[model samples]
Target: MYYLSSDLFFPSVSEANWDGVLAIGGDLSLERLQLSYKSGIFPWFEEGEPIMWWSPNPRMVLFLDELIVSKSMRNILNRNIFTVTFNQNFRDVISNCQNIERDGQNGTWITNEMIEAYCKLHELGIAKSVEVWQDKVLVGGLYGIDLGHVFCGESMFSIVSNASKVAFIALVNQLKKEDYKLLDCQVYNPHLESLGCREIDRTDFMEMLKGK
Candidate 1:
């Protein structure tokens, strides 16, 4: 580990670690947060932990065209039981994502500082959110940074079954309409795989980030 700056300009980061912890200890000011995501980095740490940055190797990403809606999911979409919208109720979305308790996780990584930081970013238009509503109740949503045509998805939550997936589908559809190059999922999981997210080398991913 190298000495990370309290100020945001990342220290010389190492690709080997793939942790991509360029800097730490800085408040997630809009400028720093925007700059970090522009360079394919993001913050993830517990409330008491010094803000940890990450850019994992073999980053997980989903192409809009690759999304695989299953038969059941397709049926759900066809029924249109839920309504999807963009940038609606961002605060609520983040709040739910932060407050929702997950199995196995001792506590939320979405610290108060993180929440305020992202809220600030949302106001600046660099960060965006996708919301899912069922009969006017906010059920699911996600938020992330938008660097030119790439969307680095930060986090998502579902209050109801398939709600998160519905929100993700809307996000992908919107990104496709907007001509985004990629939807960076950061890390891989079985759920993301089922949604068509795949791993790509960090170098290549960065190259794609730069190319766009």
Candidate 2:
């Protein structure tokens, strides 16, 4: 494992380590976070662990124009029963996603330090969130760091059935309106694939990042 230097450039990230994990044990400073997002790498690690950076091979991303709204989902979208908003309640959104009971993670990786770091990023306009609300309650949402033209999704959760999907749909639509190019889901999973996420080589992904 390479020891991280604060002065390293994006090009130093090893292509062979397409897992996107180039270095670790760095502080979550705004500069580091900014550089990471700009290069398509973000931090992901639990408390008591060194800060782990990841850039996975076959990057999973959801193109705004390609969001797959299924027949049932289309009907849900048409109903417009849920209220969708952006950056309105970021802490609430993050807290909701941190709910281990809903996330199914035995323990939460969103430690206090991580929360404060991202919250600081949000304050600086580098991180953003989309929230899904029903009956004035926050049931689902998603959060991530946003760089030039890409939003790297960190985590999402749903308290009510399909609520997280609703939040994702709102996020994609908003990105489309803003002319954003890509929504990075970071790692691939069945749930994301069902919603139109596809994998691309990290090399290709970083090339696309340069264009953005």
Candidate 3:
């Protein structure tokens, strides 16, 4: 893989290996992170590993028009049990995402450095959060980079059943109202697949990022 330096550049996404890792050793500066997402590349590595950038061949994404709300989710939405808001309590949202336990993961990728970097991005209005509140309690939420037409979802967490799902559905509805195009999910997971996210050719995904 290509090794990054202080010049603020990345190798072409086409150079990514079979596993989609394109480069390593880049600092997660705001400029680098913004440029990475704009180019359809993103950082995803373990806590102690060097910063690794990837541009997978089959990119998982959700086109706003294609978002699925199953009958169960529809019922939950009708109940209006959760209050959703945008860019509200971003730190809390990200912190929850960092601490919430997952099914198979032993640790979190949202390290302290990552959190500080993204929080800086948030201050610059380039990063955003979707908060799900239950009777004034921050029960669930998600955070991501807002790249104009696309929202590059980073992480989400739920303290109660379907809380994150409620936040996601609310986000979809808001994006639809604002005429946003795609939600970059990064990789395929059954959870996202159930929410109507699907993998498309990397070329297609890149083109979408360019508003093509």
Top of the candidates by lDDT: 3
- Of candidate 1, the 10-residue stretch with the lowest lDDT total is 11-20
How do these models rank on TM-score, best leading?
3, 1, 2
Count of residue pairs whose backbone atoms collide, per candidate: 0, 5, 0
The sequence of per-residue lDDT tens digits that candidate 1 reaches over residues 1-212 is: 44456555764335427455555566677877877777777888898888777777878999779998899999999998999989978889999999988887987999888888888888888778999999999999999888868999989999999999999988898889989889999998899999999998877788888864
Model 1 spans > 4 angstroms off: 12-22
Clash pairs for candidate 2: 19-55, 19-56, 20-54, 20-55, 21-55
Off by over 4 Å in 3: none
Q: How many clashing residue pairs, candidate 3? A: 0
Evaluate residue 152 in candidate 1 and report its C-alpha lDDT on the 0 to 100 scale: 91
Better of 1 and 2 by lDDT: 1
What lDDT would candidate 1 get against the real structure?
A: 0.84
Q: Candidate 2: TM-score?
A: 0.92
Q: 51-153, model 3: which lDDT tens digit per residue?
A: 9999998999998888899999899889899999999899999999999999999999888999999999999999999999999999998999998889999
lDDT of 2 by residue, 5-100 (tens): 666544455543635677777678878888888877778888789888777888999878889989999898788879998999998888777763
